[model samples]
Target: MSVPDTQVVVVGGGQAGLAAGYYLRRQGLDFVILDAQATPGGAWQHTWNSLHLFSPAAYSALPGRLMPPQVGEEYPDAEHVVSYLRDYEKRYDLPIERPVRVAGVHRDGELLRVQTDSGTWRAQAVISATGTWWRPFLPAVPGRAAFGGEQLHTVEYRNPGDFAGRRVIVVGGGNSGAQIAADLAYDTELTWATQRPPRFLADDIDGRALFDAATARRRALDAGRTDTGGVASLGDIVAVPPVREARDAGLLKASPMFVRLDRDGVVWADGTRAPADVVIWCTGFRPTLSHLAPLGLRGPRGHIPTADTRALAEPRLHLLGYGDWTGPASATLIGVGRPARDAAREIAGLLRA
Candidate 1:
């Protein structure tokens, strides 16, 4: 096979991509990072205005740089994170192309062909760090099409002001659902619904604890011991300041998920009806992996089965920062470094061999 264009090509310039770039640069590898966004900060730039980190800045950081502290705030907000990410890319001077939407990745002899909006390039290895934010998942709940009120997914929700004076139902029990519901409690007639009772971690619990638990879980699994469920066993929600306050004030109580949606609102399993002017589905997201479909690698669970960060069927492809399947807590800022480091090291070793 002819020489490839570069040693590696990293898709998605978010936290995960940047983390991978850090290690790739350290290894002196020739790589290019293609980011879909027009600018830096990745998904952080698109989160709700009031969104804050689950932990303090010290605990939430990318690989090389520690996120600077935010004045007068324990946990940094979305803007702070965006600023930090922009600064990180500049500080590292990583070769990143902006607004480059990768169309697909396919095998080309001994190299992988990365097709993007701009053009196509071949690399010895491709690291897909595209996280889940782009593909917001909305469940196929009954009567959803007939619901007369406006329906919005978490990605479309920017602030609570848009929901003022409106009767709204926030669906899903995870952090997004809890945080968004808390954000709207004071401004809207809100009902928070979940399939099961919402689980809130202790007031003292934060990202640090969750990361440690996830690390332990990974070690346990590697050692062929029983898994401890990691962060899921602890709780669903992180009890951030806004969520905690809302719950303490009795404004963020959880209700059982409605069986179906009506023209006016949602219908509970107990034959109760709640009138709603809007429904915000914070139902979470799926990994943005459509770009990889050309490879025909996705398994039955709608995921590309992998061992560590490398795709099992395609050793040249590495899926980073998707979720635990990629690495323990790899979706988080701090958690991504370990996996990115490993992936970069492996790619470098392969190139050398």
Candidate 2:
């Protein structure tokens, strides 16, 4: 087969990919973005129906254009965010190939060969922006397989209507867990479980503040200043409307994680069991880096060691939007732009050299 070549091949067309693309385009690099999804929107398309940005639309935009404000909505919902991302792709006239699932990436001497379902893209450098939505993680609790009731990860969750009247337990302490538990509380007999107590930002603080705090923390660390105890993480829960409503209704409390699963429910460490019909594991995701396994860059924890976004072992490759490791709050919308710009600049310098 004849292999196509480009200066750069971005491995995913989600937020991270698009952000990187914006910088690459400005740099006038010859590149193409390959997205695995059939359509635009990336993981946002699969988020629960009521899922909304913890930050306002302005704070959630990519590099080039601001996300258009929603009149009645303080936070843009999943559909709105997806629409914005789709439009962002078009507005920039980004060269994106859809339905192109990347199989693996291997180094061929000086060039990197990106193996995709459609064909191979031999490029000078590669940016792996394939976010973590595809790899949901469920903890290995005892008797997990023995539980007879329905079990799901947050990825499969779409709407709470299907869970109505059922006794459901939502697991994890992140935003997904909080929002999902809140959504289902009104419809289902619900329980929320976390490994530790859920941390909530101040009521006045939202995504913007979280982003600022993250930025400050990053800056402090870079300057060798260890005093950043007040910085909040992007993963901390933002008091979105639904969650606040749930809190007001006395349904936002979280229980300690159950030690094991039983036939009809879960058992706490104290041996108390609660009947459950469904358990939604909102335990987060592992990076989707199976394609990069051939590179042998992944560590024992399933992460690629990177100096900023650039791989430590392989400078020709970069990983974006996996989490804080790639860049401070790089997994978030507002936080991705800076690392993407820096990565694009690094790639451009390499290509020019």
| Predicted structure with the largest TM-score when compared to the true one | 1
lDDT of 1 by residue, 3-60 (tens): 2399899999999999999999999999999999999999999999999998899999
Among all candidates shown, the one with the greatest lDDT: 1
Model 1 reaches what TM-score against the true structure?
Answer: 0.98
Q: Show the lowest summed lDDT stretch of 10 residues, model 1.
A: 1-10
Runs of candidate 1 exceeding 4 Å displacement: 1-4
> How displaced is residue 240 in candidate 1, in Å?
0.7
> What is the lDDT for 342 in model 1?
97
Reference-based lDDT, residue 338, model 1 = 96
The per-residue C-alpha lDDT of model 1 at residue 305 equals: 96
How do the residues 1-353 of candidate 2 rate in per-residue lDDT, one tens digit apiece?
A: 43668999999999999999999999999999999999999999998899998788988888879999988998999899899999999999999999999999999999999988899889999999999999999899999999999999999999989999999999998889999999998889899999988887677788788777877787888899984743444346888989888987898989999999988999999989999999999998999999999999988689898889999999899999987788877888898999999999999999999
- The TM-score values for the models, in the order shown, are 0.98, 0.97
Clashing pairs in 1: none
